[model samples]
Target: MTANSLELNPVATIQSPFKSRFGIPRQSGLVPDAIGWIEPHAPWHRAEAWAGIEQYTHLWLIWQVHDRPHQPVSSVRPPRLGGNARLGVFATRSPARPNPLGLSLVRLLAMEHQAGQVRIRVGGLDLLDGTPIIDIKPHIAFTDCPPNSHSGFAQNEPERLRVDWSMLPHDEALRLNDHQRLVITQTLSLDPRPAFHDDPERVYGCPLFEFDVQFRVENGTLFVLGLNPFP
Candidate 1:
């Protein structure tokens, strides 16, 4: 048997508030307030390259799930299924695939065209900070959304956990700006804890933006413990 392989270079990189792998909404748009910036590499960073891109409201991002292990696999346990059942790798959006590539559809918020570079601000991203973006394309609804689509076992989104900020101080919560607060609230509502574990007493910490957002879960409720500066 013969083998063929191809190489690809990252076209851009993203700057996201998801400082670590923990707590990123499992799926894009789950946290509409979660934001990120995409900047092209040297050859393509020129403003002229991004001409007319602002007209579109959404985009498709093809990137590398750079932080996770991607050893070849035939099946993966989906978190949405409580990680109990195994599904073929092709059927799941797990990063542990042969290629470790990720595809996301995100909303484009704004575009900044500087003298030499183009900065694109996008929202509803579910990726790690500094993720390598392999490709970017405008999402054309007419072609991207096919008629009568079926989502299989992942048809509907998982139920969100109710976030309780009572455990956190009013002054501490007040310190965060509107966008920051929204990001924290929306991110925690997705319940980023490991799907296999449901220990109510377990304390978890997620590094979001400039602070360490810590919390716990109990009875379908998520309680924010505190927000400490990143040391």
Candidate 2:
């Protein structure tokens, strides 16, 4: 650390369907239906600071890894490598870093003023609810697009899992709105399983919007069994 290192304060808090990190997509923009918002704090909430922000269609969010509070290790086992092979921390986006920072590119959906607060709705975020956002910047297509970018060991996108909502009961199915339904389906289809485990009978639950969704994987298919109100 340098003597001149500066401190940073959260400019906003994110409101997203992912209450827990268990089911969130590994990267941003993978779940197009996953919606989220940023509620600016205090001075940042002033409308003048956000004037003309709506003109941009996408933004880059620099945020804290709120869930990764433990000390960072020099290397990590990436899930893409079957949790066996190790890689330097800098080479992987493992969330456990020396500074514990995260970056995401999300599409701006809307900007709203409710009462005295400023809310910016966004789509394609993989962030957890209440995550602290440190900064937001417009994504400039002319400068941000790089022709030399490469995926490294992650040569291709992971195969999507098959989600079968047939097991979901009528009463439970009725609880989800169209948006929530799409979010859940898209999220589950990504097979949020840890790369190390593939227990076919293990039931998992994750918070989606206002509901606690329960499901299991069987024969390579994710089955939505039920849902309960998020507590």
Candidate 3:
């Protein structure tokens, strides 16, 4: 390591229900009911490092795209445009970047310290399980949420599809609570499918908590096919 070239070490790792990248939301806070946590590593494991963090309502998580290798490229496709348009890497929030770093604003739910271990529970996890957390900062509304900001092509959040759970089978010991059900609903509404995929006949599965949610999209409405224990 050199003075000019900095190396980032993870302060913690995220514990999320999203076991894989296939069904995770493209962005955080999209599914407000989704719950996750951050477990501090050796150096940051002390409870003193997380003291008073509960006072804040939300926090900014600086993480990395550890699941995939970095693709060296100047331009990439934004999924919002159906993966048809190419833009500079910096212009889009794609994980295939020079550093593979990512930032997310998540709502803080609770903080717990048990036996010298500190765990911070959060909501709206778009990250995969065991993803490294580089840094954490409080979200300042005045600075983070600037007024009249122009987001170029992504001026607004993606459109949500209607989720239908009427077809989900009850024989599978369906024991999802209200929030868990809402998490599924909100997750599916964001339409996790790739922008290029438009096959209404195709079925997709997303693992949430302990169950695998199966579904398909037809006529703009997403239908819940069934649920199986995550394998």
Which number leads on lDDT?
1
Candidate 3: tens digits of C-alpha lDDT, residues 1-231: 797688999999999988888888888888888788898898788888888887789999999899987776899888988899999999988888888899998999988888987889999888999999999999887788888889999889899999988887776536887778888899999998989898999999988888888999999999998887887
Q: Taking the tens digit of each residue's C-alpha lDDT, what string does model 2 give over 54-167?
A: 889999999999886668889999988889999999999989888879999999999998666688999998999999999999999889987777889986887888999999
Candidate 2 matches the true fold with a TM-score of 0.94
1 versus 3: better TM-score goes to: 1
Model 3 bad stretches (over 4 Å): none
- Superposed by TM-score, candidate 1 places the C-alpha of residue 27 at a distance from the truth, in angstroms, of 1.1
Pick the TM-score winner.
1
lDDT of 1 at 174: 85
The 10 consecutive residues of candidate 2 with the worst lDDT sum are 65-74
Candidate 2 Cα errors over 4 Å, as ranges: 1-4, 114-117
Q: How many residue pairs clash (N, CA or C atoms closer than 3 angstroms) in each of the candidate models, in the order given?
A: 0, 0, 0
Relative to the true structure, candidate 2 has a C-alpha RMSD (angstroms) of 1.7
Candidate number with the higher lDDT (1 or 2): 1
